[model samples]
Target: MNLTPADTEVTGKPASRAKRPAKSAPGAATSAANAAPTTTPPVTSSPLATPTLTAGVASVTHLTEKLAEYMSPSDLKKVKEAYRFSDEMHLGQVRKSGEPYISHPIAVAEICSDWKLDAQAIMAALLHDVMEDQDVKKDELIERFGAPVAHLVDGLSKLEKIEFQSQIEAQAENFRKMLLAMASDVRVILIKLADRLHNMRTLDVMAPAKKRRIASETMEVYVPIAHRLGLNNIYRELQDLSFAHLYPLRYHVLAKAVKAARGNRREVVKKILEAVKNTLAMAEIDAEVYGREKTLYGIYKKMRSKHLTFSQVLDVYGFRVVVDSFPNCYVALGTLHSLYKPMPGKFKDYIAIRKLNGYQSLHTTLIGPYGTPVEFQIRTQEMHRTAESGVAAHWLYKTGDTNMSDLQQRTHSWLQSLLDIQQQTGDSAEFLEHVKVDLYPDSVYVFTPKSKIISLPRGATPIDFAYAIHTGIGDHTVSVTINGEAAQLRSELRNGDIVEIVTDPASRPSPSWLSFVRTGKARSAIRHHLRTINLPESIVLGRQLLTQALAAAHLEPDLPETLIERLLNESSAKSLDELYADIGIGKRMAALVARHIYGLMGGESAAMPVDHANAAELDPVTICGSEGVSVQLAQCCLPIPGDQIIGQLRRDQGLLVHTLDCTVAKRQKQKEPDRWIPVKWGSDINRRFDSRIKLLINNEKGILARVAAEIGESDANIVFVGMDEDAEHVLHQLRFTIQVKDRVHLAGLLRNVRRVAGVNRVLRERS
Candidate 1:
């Protein structure tokens, strides 16, 4: 019987694939591929009677033969069995390119075999689509193949059953699932990459829009993943293929230009190759030197990022020297430098400090004949293998080599980080965002106090460094120092800086840290900590707000369980604390909540008249400046103790205390008067508050020093200092943010600063 058209509608599969009937019951033999043959059946009389079918069978036979080289006979037999099951499940399905559906999985399997993966991984690759397209359950695969293969196949499958709110959410959730699975078994991602690579190789049949979308995903996600895993070959190929589909015109133009450039630069390349080979020979170094050209996508990226034209993109032609030993790598680099004039500041020794992905090479740029810039990379043979295959080198070599073990460890560390981020992030979309942030390839290497090297993304701050060291240290970081000098927590780290993080038992993550942290682990940890603490803090503030509102209405702070339950029911809150949190976070106004409670208490609302008395008459919520995130002093006014302050209940932000006359608080009061509440300084305030004072001084050196000395003499610590020049007046306007105990302390400090010589004027600056 001919295959029907009902089974070819999968998302990534080609549309022209001939469909088959609906999937049969589990464990049932459906096609001649799966049926037990009593004897050798004639090809023409069998179900595979077409020419394409004969070719497909021959391809499988060839694949089985190839597997025998690396796999045991029993393992090879199992692989053949998996192919048969896959063929039966995909019976009569053909691709848009007119290839049988089974060809896709077989191709994926072949790719994995090239990596010399174990038989289970190869089997999972062969049967990857059966569970995805044919409704073959994971348990059924387990019953047939085993749990390991089943798990890999299941990890490869997408979340088709559960629905998502949007396509983006669905895609993000799918990525999250796959990444988590990869953390459990790195083989899953390896096989998944193989599947994607094969699909990308055959993506021509897809529509333009689908091509662009898939290509964009491959570039944005898979390419970086490949690079991160040290799969240089796959990484480069995926980048080029994605570029071809995403920007076809540019890809073609660049490809043609590169082809022409190659011919034109052939003589230069030949000269460099000969010179390098001669130099190595004279040095008695046994090294293999080969010429190489930059990938089209790499060239394109360089051009766009550096704003350079194709002609200006020098160093596109390069050479790789594979040495016999690691030490010879440096010897080769020195030999190349001697043969050509080395470009200034164009040498890097990745051999001394390996990349986060375990890539090691010594790179140098030199001025060649006719002023052409040529690049060169030198590495050992084993390093070359790892550079090309990355984590796959662990399996490809499989000799328990130290380098391979190190590569595997690095890959697993990155995978473990993915799990850590996933645990802290609750939303699939947010988890994807954090992971993408971590995937950036640009990195800066820093050192710890103990001289331990730590790699972080460029623009990473000390907070990111702390988090990279350990989550607990990040959570409790109170101060930091760079190169033995105290530094700001938000300061961007540079290469080779010795970062030291000091922690306190009471120190906790600050919400402001979220603005500067560059690592996913730091961001996720901060967000998770905030989420964990916010609810309870909100409930406490909500209780205080509701109690204040209740006091205004002549009611007791405590209510009976029945009354509280009624309020919870009426507000649709899960509990009293939830209702309190809602009110505290301004999700529900405390006044309205109190009014509802009054009604429940059988009080006459008409008689209450909503207490519009003077705020001075009502009891105020006290602030000690250590109320955690539930209470924050407004930065605009920097309200200290003894200032007339008012609290604004902000949605999801708890209570923000501001000076009564602060411009921001005045504006917010006019807009949402109901959210404003009375607040006052506590009787026993113990911490310092930040206050800013501006000084206009003569433009003389040492003027800043005199002012700083005065502030120090007054026992006021300057937290930050900013300066601007007033050319017209020949003066420097210096603004200092200092910490003081209260308004009284700040006034005294201002007096002391006014006595400094060269000081023109000093005033407390307020927004």
Candidate 2:
């Protein structure tokens, strides 16, 4: 955002536009990508002069006077109408700082004007809060200002009328709404950013908690967005402001340090700036050179992350060299490099490969006049504008400017991705999570086999790369070859590594992939696919469990559909599918659900309320570890067919299956007995269960063969094998996971193994 109308509220969108996020797929040509848009804070105070207008007050007052540079006469008149309408709607309202609420909108409008936004955007900024704070209708605005302007205001308004489960859900929902609007007409985001900038600047009057919360949110979400949008000036100010609000002491201390550094190094900075200018002038390069200080927040981040003190954070000063044309940018860089040695590996040609945010510059750290490192950013004036304003630069430079095309495309692609992620993850919270993952500022630019630059977060892996290319490839990936070398699926991608994901139709995404995948999209896609693939099987299992529980409640199979609906409603589930899915996943005890349904049906003693808090009274479910996301087969117990089993509901992890005699289960039961659910083997246990046993075998050549043959003879396959080696021992200690029917089959296998020619003794292992 830009400078405030007074000093109270800072306004103006960043001058730069983030790179247009384009689809990066193998065989697709190069491009750039990246953030979101906001809300009305409590009425705020600012030093700007307010237009005094009373209710029913007619004004031949202001129109285009402030925006004369950007607005036409006709558009200015219409903007006046919008201002009049909005002012009246918020007539008696006052902000937290005791400012007339009307003054707030005008201040926001001023910020938009500074961005050189169109009259429609300026007018929308004036009325953005009216719809939410007052009873103004969308249709009424359309009638007065035309659909385009109405739409912009509507996009900026928070959906306060809609109920949200949490504050975060509400915030995310608002962003979703705003992004959708901004995607269609980028002006909406510009106006929203202006509003945020104004509010943040005048945030001094708010309560400590609210101030901290807003400031933290601004730092985490908005500041980066400003950076991504290339609103460097606003981005920097917002970052400093948010830092000041969130950590007042740190902000003041850091501010002083930067100030002191500037004073101490003023001579060095002046020397560097003059020397660079002289060199460029010597080379006959037309450029403007000036010294620039790094933002306070950036310096603080470096200090904290790199464990550096104030004085140790070198490169705190830099120079911006803005040239008239693109070619002169290169010429200026050459001239500067000739004057001072460029720091090895401290050079980047963003001009050749723009940042994901569409930032283009020739960045090089140099040995400056004082022998201390100084950063130099060389770019054309146009690039400089986009670098500062980011997405907002699109309006400043115009759509037809070739420099803005990459940014526009990147913005469009990123917006489309938000829509796609929203569609993929129906829940606002989850979508926000995915949004957070993609919002990480640091990204590694990797190349696909076909040389397409696929960008991912710094710690992204092959799975993230594969998914970034296509979900199908990530899901079915069988192998990966990075830079002509075969690598693990979890290999971290490095900058410039050529990654080729080898996928197979026969392969499937493993549950383990959830642990290593770094990208939110990949995580969501995997989770969604797992949910999609598992829900049907889960539902089937859930239905079977319910049927058994209903029978226990003395209910018949031909029960009325109305009763099922009632049960679903009682469970607070949207559908029977959801209800079953819940039960299948182990969220609700089948027996407990049955009891509730029975009580609803007025069964004998059903008149008595069921106390689910004492769920231990409920009959346990039949053990089948197939319930997706709900039930997990305990790795410790490794219960197979015929094992005495029990189920326990663990928070967030679903239902866990354990052997009745498992020491882990016993310990848990002793600690939280209410969680224990009775479980037994099902009638048709068709699936294989892995049962492990330890054996003491004579160290004979054919002992391994004998043990394997004996297990095969018992009709149980050896799923795994391990041996504990001891040089002094003549007997080999072996462990095996064998598939079996149940305890009965496992007991039979144990006997068969004990009778093996070289096997001396065998015992069942305890979990």
Candidate 3:
């Protein structure tokens, strides 16, 4: 807890240690008194006193009393067993604050109880750290508690014991494990979130640097994950606590500003509540209304992000109106909107289109009598309960309600997509990359031709939706229909729009699609499908051709696959399966793989040259001439229409393309540039290429988003966006490396970029 003035005096510590630096003169000649040096101590000179072992027993008793209100007799007995086990395991352990470690587990358990989670989660919370901190074994936990409870404990335990290269990596890996468990059993993440919240609340006891790192990691990883999982109560509290420690100055200032604003707007809030109550009552909509305060973190975020002052923050106060049913929620929205003039475009109907996290509400920002914008959220009593407790509401509303037929049908789509993503992504880092991109909350709900609604992230194009529905649909999608009219597949979908996909069965998956698709599931599926259909052919043909080509240099294709697998695995390819898949789609250089394979197998076939005479026999081609034979820029690397190039003839890799100046190519050339032959774009060559370019512009309001929309309008596809590097002066650079038809199309796109409102300049990159 942060100290108050009275608390500071009672604790016998200064408000800030820096205020009394213990030294008088800076450079004065030293006498006996002046010669005494000074030291800077911590702000908190002492820790909170430890709870006694007797108090530990009383605390468990207190917890048992709390549990009595929520658990059954059998569950209560299980809880007692867990408490006893944790208390015994942590018998001699103590926290840095000198408190019995048992207190930590008790506190964590109390937090889980607040979420009203299951008995297993509560028990797991009480023993989360026992396996890591003590010598307790998993078998002991399983024997004492049930296997389910033990699994939760083990999942939590790994997060503490695992060593990672960096704190961020460790947090990411832990979060990944927690999410995987949540996917199988939702309670694990719920318990983990509770543990994180309690940790953040008491983070002040640690050193300042450690506090900042912990707070930052919590804010970036756990809070977002919790929000994604719909744990709103924990999400809000964690975000606020992290903000308090991560940016103490900003937190205090924002808190003071919000407090002052609330003091001034108390009458306004009261009047609005009265007006809303009267309006609802007249409509015969029975409801319970409560005021809402903007968290300090929310305010601080707005001030720094929107560049607004406290006075300019309009939606600082609001109301959460809970009614009896979904119909009554709409009734209340109608009544409220009728009484107040809603700010233009400030209404959001999340009730019909709930967020990915299962959040549902009808939100509107209205201008009151004084022109101040006050936001109001209307929901059913069920939604209110779920809004506060989130996934835990599954237990609260129906304890034994395992028949989640409705929810399963709705949620299974996303869950199955996760499995698909994991399958397609060869490694954890790539999976995480794709998952983080999808976790962002800006989403739109569009409908299928059959009128089924699908929620996708905002800026998600019809192509993304197509892939979301089915990989085959996306792979073969030629066009789309939006509300019964022909629409481009790249067109952004909006709420309530009906969409239909037009596909061609003969069409193949384009490597360029990876740039546009948003969800991890879609990307994974596309890659998986492409590999399954194409890798075997490429590998067989590549091996045959490479075997013959390597024979010219006295090498064999009979080498063990282990050497090649080890090399590629480090780059995230699992086996020859992934390597061949990438080679088949022009995503990976076959020669690079082959050369590495040969090197590992102790062969000196690095000098083999492309066989122009047999190039056509090995792979079908549109161009064949002695000048360059059928060289094409690898769409994966987008070796531009006018650039130096090299050809690596793989065993089965038809022809691998690379920039002559590519580092990989340079290294290969050092050994053998004869293996790297010159190639050029054919005159009639027509294909899309991803030529990336960076633009630095003043960070004007809505500039970056507007630029993205403009690129979308140009029929060009932006593959990714690096986060803004700086936020101070609207001076942020966006690196938009997108796919365009050819050199002419790329030129046109660059010209369009130059015309964007905030774009300072645009240039085609040389590197």
Candidate 4:
């Protein structure tokens, strides 16, 4: 579809038409074009021969007829004039479909016309490929037609001169370019979608590799774009076409099975249809019931994803019933359920809570004749139209320009979001990534404390919801309550859940939130916050490590920032902040650098009396005993808050502050002395920490549970419980990782476990 559109690769000059004079010549819309005399349209739009692919004239005349239905005489002539000009420009070229290349754009225009686009849009579709395929300039187009049409074509054309590393990169770059253009003018996307649709219709004529590449890109980008725009008609077509090209064998197999099913189920379907028709009439329900089959791609997806064959896909046959009013939908649903047994959990009332794309219907599956599952959708006529067309319905169902409808309003929100995401994510690749994440969300709709519906992508956590509500709420999200019960921030939301995000004024976004957040908004906010906030925190940690190392070398830790700068002047880094950042991010070692700086200061090679006045600067880290991500007790040492701790600054690995004199800490200190830093207990130690302990207990009935209960009595939670097998049957060593406040709490838990009937010995694990 794009290849014929000049996609910026084809150069050309103006093919003149009766319009504005050439303003910006070659390169301004600068491309080569075959200039022509200006005699654009006969002020009247006489109905031309309807354009059918198999029409009398397979030339532009065929396309002329298709436009005859919608366009006025004057508009039709203008379209024909643009077509003739484009034809002359692409005189000898042809598409991979082996048709005159001009035929492609004409077909694209026809598609746009079917969507009820304006004269300018149809004309833009006609000339879209001219700049890329032929030697046509933007100025020439502007001169021949109007600026609006030219702008639309320019937006559709691919930037061709820049070389991409691979076909995929070029495709991504092309999409990025096109998306920005579409964001400025919504019509650009409609035309581009038409262009892509036409291209896909003729894609089978291309090579296998090219076909798959185009089809895959279509699946990932265009299909989702159509869906996001609520262009369900186009979305389905693109999906089916892409499925055919991407997985031909699967599509063929599924198509054959569906065909066979239709033949086999004809009689049964007829009987059920009649029964439903009669039931509706008797109940005074006015409705139109029609039998429908799922698309090949839909069936194939179910097969692949759900691991089911064609036979097992129960709801392959479906029915859509359109009624008079919203209330009638429920009436019809009740009537259908009374007529047949409804399958449990197969009913979804989207009418009450519409899908994010604005689809609404009451869906129910029932056991039809022969035990086959028959799915039914009940909606009003307007809902039916909106359901099928999505955002496009508002435009397609109208003649002239209409007021902005609800569908358009939501779409505008999505469009503006692209610009917002682009601002937050500067890299084009990253921008694409963020956009893609939002594009294809399989949503889970939840509720607020006020019972307001909040729909988010499936697998999205409460943290994502907090961020979605507002950055302030997200920053201060201290706790969550799902249905009035306390839950963690990482809790995955289910449908119908009433989630409450409890905020504390002092709390901030944690680095750990990034691990479970599923939405682009939360991911971006957390990343932005981390990049800005972590630098200072890491710098402080680096300085602390440096100070402790300097103290260990019997040197004064009172050096000011300026003093440290002079000491590190010989290094490439210019300032203390730079050196601190380097040390914090693992680029340099604190102890080695500190010792080197001490040597440069020309310190005496002797010990000095120290009052340790700077003990306030080297302070202990405050941590809750709970597994709060960043802070952790070293498993080898099981250091409690009261223990004298030595911290190791493992870059990106977080800190594993260990108790002094622990065997593992001693080895790590010896191997990487620079990594060892000073640490102590903070006054406000809250939450529990897991400590491994060995409990030798006699193997007895329910003995393990008894020991666990005893540990639980000590207010300790069982983190892990495993038996050391291959020991005597009567006596066994149980290895447990139990959560406790500290060594003192563990001591209390050990006594409790030792009191259990089968207990022999309870000792803290050290090896």
Superior candidate under TM-score, 1 versus 4: 1
Ranked by lDDT, top first: 1, 2, 4, 3
Off by over 4 Å in 1: 1-11, 14-58, 94-98, 163-166, 395-404, 540-627, 630-730, 738-767
TM-score of each: 0.75, 0.76, 0.68, 0.67
Better of 1 and 3 by TM-score: 1
Per-residue C-alpha lDDT of model 2 across residues 86-121, encoded as one tens digit per residue: 655655455555555566677678767766778778
How does model 2 fare in lDDT?
0.71
Residue-level lDDT tens digits of model 3 in 415-488: 45656677676445556666776767678889998988888888788888888788778889888889999987
Tell how far residue 437 is off in model 2, in angstroms: 1.5
- TM-score of predicted structure 3: 0.68
Distance (Å) between predicted and true CA of 232, model 1? 0.6
lDDT, model 4, position 637: 73
Model 4: CA > 4 A from native: 1-58, 66-68, 72-78, 134-144, 161-170, 395-404, 535-767
Best-fitting candidate, scored by TM-score: 2
Candidate order by decreasing TM-score:
2, 1, 3, 4
- Candidate 4 per-residue lDDT over residues 664-700, each given as its tens digit: 9898788877565566776677666667889887777
Q: Which candidate, 2 or 4, would have the higher TM-score against the true structure?
A: 2
lDDT (Cα atoms) of all candidates against the true structure: 0.80, 0.71, 0.65, 0.70
Model 1, residue 307: distance off in Å is 1.6
Candidate 2's TM-score: 0.76
Find the candidate with the highest lDDT and give its number: 1
